[model samples]
Target: MSTYVVTGCAGFIGSNLVDRLLAVGHNVIGIDDFSTGQRRFLESSLKSERFRLVELDLLDIDALQRAIKGGEFVLHLAANADVRFGTLHPRRDLEQNTIATYNVLEAMRANGINQIGFSSTGSVYGEAKVIPTPEDAPFPIQTSLYGASKCAGEGLISAYCEGFGFRACVFRFVSILGERYTHGHVFDFYRSLRANPNELPVLGNGKQRKSYLYVQDCIDAILLAMEKAPEKFNVYNLGVDSYCEVNDSIGWICEALKVSPRLAYSGGDRGWIGDNPFIFLDTARIRALGWTPKLTIKEGVLKTVEFLQANEWVFGARD
Candidate 1:
């Protein structure tokens, strides 16, 4: 079995990926600093004999090199995921997302690891003129620091592939939702409803269009890309074929929770600085590899609501 090193192993998607990797009998080295990730998410993986958890930040170059040594593949997912508040802390995205990614690449190079997978975001498209932005869609002016940082990270990976002959797979994900989801609009809306079931403050006009993929489907796409995509540097958009409006998702959540809270619009087309009003991704490339999401947007939203309802403690935990 191959040994895989997964950064951000305690975060939502990272933990899920770690569990899947270990389940298939692969040795896994998981790295996390607990800055935005939670230990509880890794509870199952932590019990596996083939799993090793390294508690350190990616910026710690020495420690990072040590963690990645002898690993055949690296799945880099750690990042400052606070898109809404990124403007509040201007340098947070740069240091956490961009710089950390560069550090990981350097560590991989130092340890002679040639394969790296990155978890990028669809926000990199910014306000794309295309309805369902394809992988080759022209990049518009980035609206958020988080998006800009991710874009920079993608560039670094590409350069590493061309310069060092490393193989790389970059998956641009739409907003993901499923079990262990602790952040994003779904979590925010759920927390607001829990705090006061009578009224809910909806961000923006709730007319913004977007796409989402269930976490399992996202993992499936990542694994498929790694195993099936034949390219020195590959890029794929991991998302469903359809899109949904923010209001529609809110409606689904409310239906799942059986709460009809008074909707309070925050008075804007977008939620905050760097918020894209439309974010539908064209998943043709990944689909060409025979990978498709299993859950629909409505089903994913309902499942997220159900998971949060059962695990209310995640709201108060790291997010």
Candidate 2:
């Protein structure tokens, strides 16, 4: 079992990865500043002797290098995970999401780490012209600063992988929904209904459709990609192929909550400045590697809603 350094280890996806790695008895060193991730989320893993948590910001190069020093591979997932927040505070988004990634790469290089797996997003393909956006989708004009930052990070990874001969995998993830997911559309809908028990805030006329991947599937693909990583850079699109619209997801949440909520819209058909109306990822390349998502959009959303309902305190504290 190789020692791994996982950035954003306290976040939803990172925490899940930690659980899996620990289950398999792999030694893991995790680093997170808890800006978006939570310390409480990793309490279970912290109890394990194989796990170590470094409470340091990724922007601190020395700290990151120290955390990653003896690790054989790095899983880079630290980021400003909110697109709306990116619109409101562009500088913070770029600095944290983009610049932090650059720093992580530099730290890995300094530590002589040549293997990395980056958690990228489908947002980089902003409003794709084709359905099931491929890995080589021209990386269309990204709208939000968040998307641009992710694209920039991907570019940096590619350059590093090629120039330094490191093994790297870039996963363009869709909307991830599952246990511990506290910030996606599913979580947002559940919170809104719980607060009012009657009114649900609907963004964009609710016509938006996109694939949603369960957290387990996200973890599975990451591990599989690492197992199948190439000597050079490799990028893959990951998501459940089927698309579910925003309004439809709201309906699912209401049914699960057993609440009849009035729908409220922000109007204008466009949800937000950087929102993509519809997107589907082509997982053929990753699927060709024999990795398949086990959860559909509905299954993922329903389970996520249940988790959100059961753990109201997690979302409640931030509210």
Candidate 3:
């Protein structure tokens, strides 16, 4: 019955992690700003007596410190995740991701809390030279502001671990999909097709190779690493073993919906300013701890389509 403080508890991954924590009889305090997170995602957790939801942004350092006072571990997942449009508001990622992470670390230090699990991204690899980028892959120049912000967050966590005697596990994730998924290419494609089933406007050339992990598999890896990995500051690339092209995912989504929309691709290989053409992570490190993804890339894509179909209100609710 360990007490855990989870930031971004109302978001997709945050809410799911809260659910898992409560199911295991742990007391959880969830914090979120509702900027991109939805209240519906936390509906189930809200009813539990052991779960408490705090509607506040991490930028409020004073309130953040108070909220995290008695927690044993912090699961930091709150961030500005809009990579494509991040450049539009450049300061958003810096404030929401990097500075917010610093605030969390400082709060933990003040309260004498020593353990943290951070949600990082594979985007830090930028356009990597390696096909299956490992944990030790050399970091190329960051392509997106979101990635740069996360990298900064990771650095802060590591420094805190070394100087403050804190223990941290940073999980670099691929694009995740499953129930409660609100944004990303799959959601965009589904919404576009629903408006007009005959035609679809594809971003980029639909040839960009990427990897995706089911949301549950992602959560499983996080919990496993937190429990098993015994390092002062650990980093693991959490993803599936295989990769899929954007066109392959589009095909899966269309097949699931029983629609053959005319594909209209926006010219160029990169979908957006910071979109990576290829992102496949080597998950052998996490696998060494007996963690493996249960769903295939195709299965995850189809499941995302089905979840969107059933939960159409998420579109309006989140947007």
Candidate 4:
């Protein structure tokens, strides 16, 4: 069994990954400061004998280097993912996503861990010139600090691969949906509807296009690439085949919750600063690896809403 060190251990995706790794007969050392992560998410994994949690921030280089000792691989997912409010706190993206990623690489190098998997975002392709943006698509001018920081993180990982001979797999994921989903449109809409089922303030014009993937499917794609892809520095976009409009997802969430709140659109094409009106990523590279998402966009949306309805505590936990 392999011993893996997972940063962002208490997060939506990280916690789920910890559980999966343990289930597959692997040992996991989970690291998290619980800044944006929910402690409840790690409950299941914390119970496992093969799992150990290290409570600390990633910026503490010495602590991180010591904690990741003897790890065969590293999964770095911790980041300030608040894209809409990135302009409000610009330095957060830099410190949390970019600098934190640097710390992870340095920690790996110090501990002699050669393999690392990074969770990147599709937002890196701001106003993508190509529809269904491919892995090789030319990067446009960065529209958001969040995307820019992640782009910088990617650069650091690539440099480490060349300079240190570190093997790296970076997965650029579209917005993820499914159980333990505590953020995004579904959560926002659910909270709004709960306060007043009569009306919901919609972001954008309810027409911005986006692609989403189930969390489990995202995990599967990343794991598959990390194990099978034969490359020193591999990059893959993890997403479903199709895209959906904001209104499409809103309809599914409302249908699942049995609520038809008035859709009040904010007067704009984009929701906030750096918000892309259309984001559809090409996933042919990962699909070629024989990985397929089990749920459609509508199904994923409904499933997310169902999870929110059952686990209302996540709303308060996030606050």
* Candidate 3 local lDDT, 77-130, one digit each (tens): 999999999989999999999999999999999999999999999999999999
Please give the lDDT score for candidate 2.
Answer: 0.87
| TM-score quality measure for candidate 3 | 0.99
Which candidate gets the maximum lDDT versus the true structure?
Answer: 3
Cα error, residue 98 of model 4, in Å, equals: 0.5
Which residue runs of candidate 3 sit more than 4 Å off their true CA positions?
A: none
For candidate 1, what is the lDDT?
Answer: 0.92
Return the lDDT, model 2, position 181. Answer: 89
Q: Candidate 4 at residue 223, lDDT?
A: 87
Model 2, stretches more than 4 Å misplaced?
A: none
* Candidate 4 to truth, TM: 0.99
> For model 1, where is the 10-residue window of minimal lDDT?
310-319
Local accuracy of candidate 4 as per-residue lDDT tens digits, 1-319: 9999999989889998999999999999999999989999988888899998999989999999999998999999999999999989999999999999999999999888999999999999999999899999999999999999999999999999999999999999999998899889888998999999889999889989999999999899988998988899999998888999999888887887788889999878999999999988999999888899998988888888888889999988888
Each prediction's number of clashing residue pairs: 0, 0, 0, 0
In terms of lDDT, the poorest run of 10 residues in model 4 is 249-258
Q: Give TM-scores for every candidate, taking all chains together and pairing residue i with residue i.
A: 0.98, 0.97, 0.99, 0.99
Candidate 1 differs from the real structure by a C-alpha RMSD in angstroms, to one decimal, of 0.9
**Location of the lowest summed lDDT over 10 successive residues in candidate 3:** 310-319
